[model samples]
Target chain A: MSRIKAVDILAGGFVVLIGVLAIVESTSFDMGTSRRIGPGYFPFYVGVLMVLLGLVIAVENLWTRTASDFGWSLPPMRSPFLILAAVAAFAVMIERFGMFPSIFVAVFLGSLADTNTSIWQKLTISVAVPAVCVAIFKYGLSLNVDVIRWRP
Target chain B: MSDFASNLALGFSVAFSWQAMWYCFVGVTLGTFIGVLPGIGALAAIALLLPLTFGMEPAHALIMLAGIYYGSNYGGSTASILLNLPGTPSSAVTCIEGYPMSQQGRAGVALFMTAIASFIGSICGMLIMAIFSPPIAALAFSFSAPEFFSLMVLGMVAASTLASGSPIKGLAMIGLGLILGMVGRDLYSGLLRFSYGVDQLYEGLPLVAVALGIFGLPEVIKNAGQITGRTVEARSISFASMWPTRDDWRRSWGAMFRGTGLGSFFGALPGTGGLLASFMSYATERRVAKDPSRFGKGAIEGIAGPEAANNAAVQTAFIPTLTLGIPGDIVMAIMLGALTIHGIQPGVSVINNHPDLFWGLLVSFLFGNLMLLILNIPLIGLWVRILAIPYWVLYPFIIAFICIGVYSVSNSVVDLYVLMFFGVLGILMNILRFEPAPLVLGLILGPMLEENLRRSLTLYRGSYTVFLTRPISALFIGIAVLILAWTIYGMFRARARRRAALAAGGE
Candidate 1:
């Protein structure tokens, strides 16, 4: 099969699986009395229709010669990966240090995803932006938040 | 109607306060900042700040949030034309043709046209909102279950006409999305439909998780490999001029007006949303333009029409949400969630009971759009310069910001995990050429569909004909039939042409 067709087939299969799960779950419900249709009624129909659509797509993929313009290419993943890691670390520290310190650290570390930046410059920006934000949001406006939790 | 006018006066009184004006300014500025950044959307920005809003008056909070929405719409186009990356869905159509203009070194023209179109569209939509709101709001209050169901059906069917490459594929995607929309507990029975016994499954899919994963993560991966790569020749981004020339204005003004009409109506339609607005604006401009072939190439009209339609749709979408309590889009839904949390129920009665909120919100929306237009134009230079930053320096910061933003939504680690999973899913979907826009539409519209459909079905009592027997419902069904017939005929004709071509080749 052509790559595009193959991709379609795979996606269709995943969708079908999801449809089947929806159908089974909907069926598990009582669907209510004649005068009042249960919550499952609409979902049941939606699930069935989705499965049918997925089947149609799968069949079309099997029958047709898929188009040629289908591939995934890009620049690199290192910086993206590092940025993701920094965010994950920030999330980890958020409850401990609060929104103020955490966002700064994350943005600063994230800026480092570009290798050319000096460490001192990154640190300066990282600390400064968050500090200013804390003052504006916390002290000046009295928008409530824990600014210096661990320090106190 | 007199009550509405009086209430509106009250709202303006509150909104015109210095505190409110400053809040609006802050919101728009922050909104523009985030909008300039690729992959960071208004939803995420609002979600992060939702915590802060917990302490403020509802009107002040909503006005600020409204500013962010309009500001982001203005901001996203800058990145789209300059870097081929749309900051928001409103700007997606801009990239369809605007990016090519940038490649040809007319990025200045594209940027200038977009700003003008957006401003004009905003004013037109706001005018429409002001003039027709009383009547529209009154009409919306009468919408029954069947009407809502029909509206959703029309939206999903109309959605099929969006993509250009393959109409059938788009329909299939829409169907698949609608089915995904059915997942989770049946709202009436309290019965789980597809949870597979997982607790999180009970809530079904998180729209934010899905959106961030689908739109945000994939773009990151695509740009990841290029972090160190600098391919494009560094052309000087135009910082000198902000306005379009008179000739440019003459060409675009008609499109801008037509786009406002289309966008305002589409915005008022339940489930149709901004995606339809963007696509329809582009198609309408392409059809109406003197030179149709200029579309998808560096045509300034391409930028103008869709940008106008997008901003107009953003403004008009509030009509349904405020009057009928039916959210016209996902942002409206989130806004609804915020209002509901504050014990505020929206409807005709809201105009009488909370005049402060009613007029304040309406007036704030006006000032917010004006603020967005004023603040955004000068910052276009700053946004253009950011496009010059290398991918290596840009991608990591993007990923980090998204992570922090996602975590801040609920301050949950599980949310971060969900974000990562969806990001990977988003990347895979991109690689596979599956468009995630329909998936988002499906997810956002899923709950509403289930609620309305079940309500209609219960009223009919197993007769299925209520959809046809009811006047509004019948009209929708008839419309759906006509659309289907036309689509099928077109497909048949295309098939016949292909077969004849094959026969000629064989001979």
Candidate 2:
């Protein structure tokens, strides 16, 4: 079997795409002279180096083994999905509902990432965490965030 | 000697204040609690606490933050000794001997000795920092744009190459970080570079958000439900149980001093830090042992050397950050960002501009180490119980804290989105086997490097040879080149050997 792993291809392709994006974007910015180089100059050069390095990573993986054998599949997404959703939920809610509700929803969604927890445990945590947080951040620290404003 | 005495007096005066002492106590206590937990690390803990320090005086804020950094080192060995898990990355070396010692039913002695060694290491490292920083700061005054640029290059190269993982991947991550660093308004041209209509990003990528997203969230994502470490046996570590035998005492002192020496040297380097020092100390101890077989089998020197080494490295790691404004690692980089957020510019001028701040931090280390020594020895039982706090209970609080902390940075919701973006990016990078340390370093150093490069080119009329013509700049670039060559050569040799092995196996 070929030693090349899915990780190397994904990583290399993504990096090269970033390099191309950088190089293409620099075209809109002014590329001044070497003595008075513009914003584009540094990134453009960095993009070139990135492309070279990315190519090395992609090609080098073809005949050599990676540190771990991840095989040919995407990584599992259970934790990443739940955890990211938790953060996203907070971002959407924080300004509208303020700190307490936002933290409440965020903690609830985050607690779901660990499937080992019972429903009661999650509920208790969802309630208790926000209370403590409100007490600490809003009451004690006097952070600018609101606890339960209904601005929306 | 008198000058040193007076400076220390100034330090004590600042540190001995009620407010400073209170914050310092809070920081170390919080630091120990965070460090004793498995699946979290000192880097994430520091980032989590950074926002809370925003309202304080810069000196008090830094004193607390520095307390967290070193106090965590003292608490880090707890998990390594009691369970086989390393609570912090630098303490991973402690696992080699520490776990074995615990298995042999000598857990208390191991804990006690580590506290003693860590105390010695920290005190010695602080002294070294006091003696060396002024001279280094003075020397840095002579540096210009080219020298700074070359030194940054050297730092970047060393950081990406010497750190574990594929050197190519590490370099690629740095490239990505440099691009990320350019995501705001161009300072000289007054034009936005890569913000893409995000108004909040005009200043730059929020350092706290990116740091949390990259280092903090990724750790949570990877280890969320899986960190049920080995159940620690209830080791009742009373004062009598904690005492080392006379033979144990004999073997440890020499190793502690030697490890302190190695750690002090490595910690002052711009890119390496406690992790490398601890590992190198472990290797040195094994090499010098009368019977090398005793290592990894509860050899007292094994624990003594590395615990001392990592703690010492923690103290000296501040030297480069506080003096030259170059971080020894990601944690130091965050500390630098803290100073910047507090309106204190970090550079050679830092020491001269703010002696009270510098000396106050030094004296606080003295107090913080003593605090850790107290907390780690007599209070060993309390931490053992703390280690039992399951991962499910812990990570949700971490998520809440990360969100709140990032929001508190500017009271802006946009940073929350930035947190989400980097959180996803960090996960992808992890799956790709890319190390995040070098990228963070690159992000931190990117602006300074680009600015210096532009200035040097403009000053020397675009003569590329100016980097080579300047003596110190040339030396820095030369070291960078040598490191690059050595890494490439090492990779090739490893590849060739692997190929030969495959051929011999009739593959």
Residue B304 miss distance in model 2 (angstroms): 1.5
For model 2, name the residue pairs that clash.
none
- After TM-score superposition, what is the CA distance of residue A74 in candidate 2 from its true location, in Å? 4.2
lDDT of each: 0.68, 0.88
Tens digits of per-residue lDDT for model 1 on A1-152?
Answer: 35666666776776677668667766867666546777666657667876876776665544343235445344356655665666566666666777566767776666665566578767766776566666655576564446646732
lDDT agreement of model 1 with the native: 0.68
Instruction: Indicate the TM-score of model 2.
Output: 0.97
In model 1, the fraction of reference contacts reproduced equals 0.45
Q: How much is the TM-score of the A chain of model 2? A: 0.90
- Alpha-carbon deviation at A46 in model 1, angstroms: 2.8
Clashing residue pairs found in predicted model 1:
A75-B225, A75-B226, A76-B224, A76-B225, A76-B226, A77-B224, B11-B359, B11-B360, B227-B392
- Can you tell me the CAPRI class of model 2? medium
DockQ of 2: 0.73
Q: Give chain A TM for each model in order.
A: 0.66, 0.90
TM-score of each: 0.80, 0.97
Report the C-alpha displacement of residue A69, candidate 1, in angstroms. 4.7
